[model samples]
Target: MKDNKQSEKDSSADNVDEYLQTLGNEDARERRYYSQEQPFSADEMTRLVNEERLNALLAQSDAFLSSLNSEIKDFNDEC
Candidate 1:
């Protein structure tokens, strides 16, 4: 019974090692596929990030202008 328990533990450890190795192999394959198959470029990524930043800035500017206009309107009404 003791020997059987040891064998079971060894088998479980082996299975875990095998599973980890398989996961590593799959991750490597995915990285290779993305590197080879994807059309994404560093320059394009940079451009996209810059565009997003500019868009956010423009939105903030528009909101600020609208709020300032409203405040001016309220002041003119008080006058």
Candidate 2:
């Protein structure tokens, strides 16, 4: 059972790596700022918004993990 959970975690990590790679590729595209400002099509704008939300969520998650680590360290020290 523990091995299954470990494997699932590993797979999720791999998926995250792949997603980051894909995002990097997408972000590398050149923007045509000087051209006529075309309103962002719905799908593209939605994706951008979702990515922004995802980044915010990730930041919160990192902060939460850091807090947990500090609490665990303090607990261990008190033992």
Total backbone clashes of candidate 2, pairs 3 or more residues apart or in separate chains: 0
Each prediction's Cα RMSD?
8.2, 20.8
Residue 34 shift from truth in candidate 2, angstroms? 46
| Local distance difference test, candidate 2 | 0.87
Q: Give one digit per residue, the lDDT tens place, for model 2 in 1-79.
A: 9999999999999999999998877665434343547788989887778787789999999999999999999999999
* Model 1 segments more than 4 A misplaced: 38-79
Give lDDT per model, in order.
Answer: 0.94, 0.87
TM-score (C-alpha) between model 2 and the true structure = 0.39
Displacement of the residue 35 alpha carbon in candidate 1, Å: 1.0
For candidate 1, the lDDT comes to 0.94
Decoy 1 TM-score against native: 0.47
Measured with C-alpha atoms, the lDDT of residue 77 in candidate 2 is 100
lDDT of candidate 2 at residue 52, scale 0 to 100: 77
Error of 2 at 46 (Å): 8.8
- Score residue 51 of candidate 2 by CA lDDT: 82
lDDT of 2 at 6: 100
For model 2, the superposed segments whose C-alpha errors exceed 4 Å read 1-49
